[model samples]
Target chain A: MVRWEPGTAERLQKVALELFATRGYEQTTAAEIAQAVGLTERTFFRHFSDKREVLFQGQELLVQAFLDGIEAAPEDASPFEVVACALRSAATFFPDERRPHSRTRQSVIDRNPALQEREHHKLTTLATTVATALRARGVDDVAATLAAESGATVFGIAFTRWLREERSLADIAAEVLAELLTLAARALRPAR
Target chain B: MVRWEPGTAERLQKVALELFATRGYEQTTAAEIAQAVGLTERTFFRHFSDKREVLFQGQELLVQAFLDGIEAAPEDASPFEVVACALRSAATFFPDERRPHSRTRQSVIDRNPALQEREHHKLTTLATTVATALRARGVDDVAATLAAESGATVFGIAFTRWLREERSLADIAAEVLAELLTLAARALRPAR
Candidate 1:
């Protein structure tokens, strides 16, 4: 039987990121991660399916925040309003404290094609989850899909900007959302 | 030295698709595809890097059509209009005759996660290409990215509908574009 330990998952994740940043993702091993944290490989596996999953630990919370926000939105809110609110609520998931770690993780992911693919998959899943939530809220199919995808797009642009600039995620998200709405308004403007 | 043959690539693609549909994608081999086409595996490699490439043969033509349409769009066209025109022009690339083949290929791809990832990657690349084209036309970065991604979303929805229904690709594309515009208009409308 294995002994249970406190903060094993968090410790493993921090150590794994440090190792990946220093030695590169491909060169790092799960055994090395566990050894660095003074835990068994079994403990590491119990937390993350693989080393790559360490970088995506917050995905579940992000999705939940989005869904919860949509669910809690005002009943009469427009589709875009609901999505905007959901995004604003989800922004809190990435608080100021986590920004540095997220930036580091994104940098590591940027260097690897496989990690990029996984990230894209995660974003796609998030969009789908948001769409389902919208549908459940009685929004029509196409509107729900477009709103959810638009939300995902805004999140991506905001997150990238937040990483590079000093703006908060909420501020960046609000700015991006307004920009998208403006773009949409211009693009959909009636021909004279 | 291998003898050059006419229609070899087309023959290989047809034969490969047949094999994939009948025997499943994972079960089919490059050797089997070449053997069925009465060519060596060398010829198959010359035509395609791998089996999955056969399913995605039209990606290049699709990208080219989108780029050409964007380039040829009127100077006064909005980013969304440019993308709409580009999508309409690209619709011609998928006439009714090819729908049956595309439907089969899509069915095969839908069953496999790896193929879906490749398809998503291809769509992402197309969006980037379209965004680059828009940027070249003097559109701002954020708008260009949004327009291009929105176009990709429209194309995906239109293509899926075209495959399932009897509507022409152009008709389906136009309808989807209009719906997107309407969605945008409603979503972006100022709160009363």
Candidate 2:
């Protein structure tokens, strides 16, 4: 077995994003990314299943951050409260220093339909995982699902805005959550 | 070009779902589905790009139902109200007669990871399309997105329940929407 190198995945992901952004996702190769990071192709494959997997590196950690937030919430917190904590915790996963990296990563994904689909799949997974976590907290099925889905939607919209705006992800996510609540509270017209 | 058959697509979809459930989705072939429906393989290709596409045959119509719901709403309806209309409209697309079909279709998807991914993608597309329709109706971007996403979530949850319960899709969807609003209104604990 090849000895694992600390920070190897992070370094490779950074280099891969840069290459994907500059050379076009379709034109770049996993071998090229490995070479750029001064690593062998086998080592790159060790860290990621493919070039696409490299771009999606840290997806598990992102989901964990949200889950961690849920775990860190008050024992008696409401479903929305638990989700808020989870979102806030998730926000910390993307600090100011990571903004440029995220921007570049998102730009690369935006240019590729497959990447966009993968990103959407990631968010869907995040929602389901979070919902399961919420249910574990004794939140009922429907409430847990709705809150978790709402949180994922808020994160997605806020993350997109954060890429363009100067606001912090946490702040943007909070605002998005508030707006979602406001929209949800709006009265619907009577069914004809 | 071969002459179009009015009910060819629907008939093929029904037969494909039946075959996928009994014969196994992996074991079934597009040619078999077409032949079962008394048509040529070329006709099958004409209606659907491939076997996978056969399962998602009504995706466009489902999306159109949501849009039609938005269009049918009152001109001055609020964002949530507009989504309610859309969900109600969409529910009509899956009447009682369609439940068995949907149940079989969902079972096939549940057994196959690829079909599950495609189903998730379809729902994502539906959310984006509904959001765009909301925007075109003069709703702000954030409200439109939040409402559209929320609407999709409700539809998903209700659809799952509709498959198991005897209640109508529209009723289940309405209850789900109301429950979502109640969850959204719950108080959040102070951040740490």
Candidate 3:
């Protein structure tokens, strides 16, 4: 969807979230969203199933990109390194210029409880997809799940930092993975 | 909500989840859910706002319990110790007999995309709240947030394992935290 009509789809997402933040999720309709974006209802429906999906348009791509990154990792990389590479790959997935739209999409998600739930589902899907990718690369069982999950956790911190801090996504991700390692070390204190 | 109504509300939740799984969330109504559970529509409304709320009833208490655990920790405990204690507090927050309902709740949540997102928001909220709690306990800025998020990350792995695996929640949390720490130690090795 982003590839087809990047600007229109992103603009719809931004306008929809703004409306969702101010006017509320259910109260706002497809027409209202399209009008705000200067698009027709048919154009709106072309990109989104309904108003709720505007927040989730790029989800499929994100999940696929995560899998692709894992599969594309260097053969010598450890499972953790493979996951770290996936986090780095996410840097190119979303356009940096579209932070405002991304922020608005988040705002709408924050305001709407249902949309918030869907967002979690999206991440979980990404995590599972990641795990599958890892398994394909010969890392199986709990390790795959854990690595994939670890990747998602790192991704969450990175994305949050990207939202709040004045840094590139890669730096934010690197910082999070580093801190996560520190915490994980602290968590594994030998029984004393 | 759990402290007050307990089983009646839980019964509604289970029944609603079954209905939602079978009939779809959009097709299911409050009256139908109430009928299946032998409760009145009025009682159903009392317990939940909509079909979705039924899926996320007890998570708030879980987050609250995490906060309480952090606040109740000894004066000199490190931020990591405080977060670990908070994760341990879930044992007291949920009773032993409630385990079945616990899995059922997770199953229902797993089946529904929307419910999963709500669960994720609750998790992110829990992490932030725990970080804020640690700050109040005298931990400084980046360290406090890092500790909180790391705890949240470990807790997530623990919680996900607890829900899926037959092991006790406390046990899985302890193991994941331990393993994550080992992983982090390896990651933090200084470059030659």
Candidate 4:
């Protein structure tokens, strides 16, 4: 999706996170955030339906894009491999410079339950979409669900590492995914 | 910690899920559920604050109880050991025969974004709480976070397995945690 209101959405989100941290998420109002950005409540609604939504708009896009990518991926790929590749493909959407902003956004979501929940919904939706794509490619329902949901575990690791300033998102993602493959191999291994 | 309105909650959940399946989640009303249950709308509100909350009330308590178990564990235990033990301890709270109900409940949440978000909030809160508990036991923040969050990943695996009717919740949880530990150790293997 194109960025509407140009920098206005990010501006409001930045102000909202700052206000939420200082004054608390519950204490901050959309009106206050909009006013801080020299915009009206109507403008705030136009950008984000609610303060919680501000923390999640990019994530929603990420989910949709990642799902779309999976749907368009080649047929006959392993379910986990397909979703993993799709997850990696999303790296282009998150540049190295976005790390600081990404961490700050996570912090805001971390502090508030409502925002956190919205984020979780987006994530779960992404996983399910991946699973559906897998099923379409001939993976059974059980394996599809496992592949898609388990892939989120690796994604979470990549995402957390991406937020750190030192490692590039691409590098961290590669490392985490390599580790996830290792983990999966071990999970599939019978106790010896 | 306790099971109040056990059969009522379980029954209401089933009827609601069936309604959701047939008529869609948004169109279903509290009045309809109440009438289906041979209860009044007041009774439905008494059990659940709102229609959405109905699907969510027990999980927070469950995760919190699991965290509390870990925090109260022996001081010298490894992080995974504590979490695994905590999960085993928490198993005492589950009903003896409710796999079908559990699966159905998850299906309901899976279909509804709002409900799914609430479930995510509960899960993230549990991980944070588990991390805090580890810190209280003198573990540092990063390791504790990794252990706590990874423990949750294990729990997620165990939870998915438990929802399947193939095995009892307690037994599947034990096996799955073992699987997670193996997976985690591979993911976090120390450099030689």
Tens-digit lDDT string for candidate 2 (B154-187)? 9999999999998999999999999988777665
The most accurate candidate by TM-score is 1
In the predicted model 3, the residue pairs found to clash are: A117-B117, A117-B118, A184-B181, A185-B181
Give candidate 3's error at residue A19 in angstroms: 8.1
Per-candidate TM-scores read 0.93, 0.91, 0.71, 0.61
lDDT of each residue in B27-49, candidate 3, tens digit only: 88999999997989998889888
TM-score of chain B of each: 0.94, 0.91, 0.85, 0.81
lDDT of candidate 1 over A1-192, digit per residue (tens) = 122234878888888888998899999999999999788888889989988888887688889989888988889888888988898888888777778778889889999999998898888999999999999999988778888888898898888888998878999998888887777677666785
By TM-score, the better pick of 1 and 4 is 1
Query: Candidate 1: which pairs clash?
Result: none
DockQ, per model, reads 0.56, 0.66, 0.30, 0.12
Q: Where's the lowest-lDDT run of ten residues in candidate 2 chain A?
A: A1-10
Candidate rank order under lDDT: 2, 1, 3, 4
Instruction: Report how far off residue B99 is in candidate 4 (Å).
Output: 4.6
Q: Compute the interface RMSD for candidate 3.
A: 3.1
Model with the higher lDDT, candidate 2 or 3: 2
| Best prediction by lDDT | 2
Clashing pairs in 4: none
Global Cα lDDT for candidate 3: 0.74
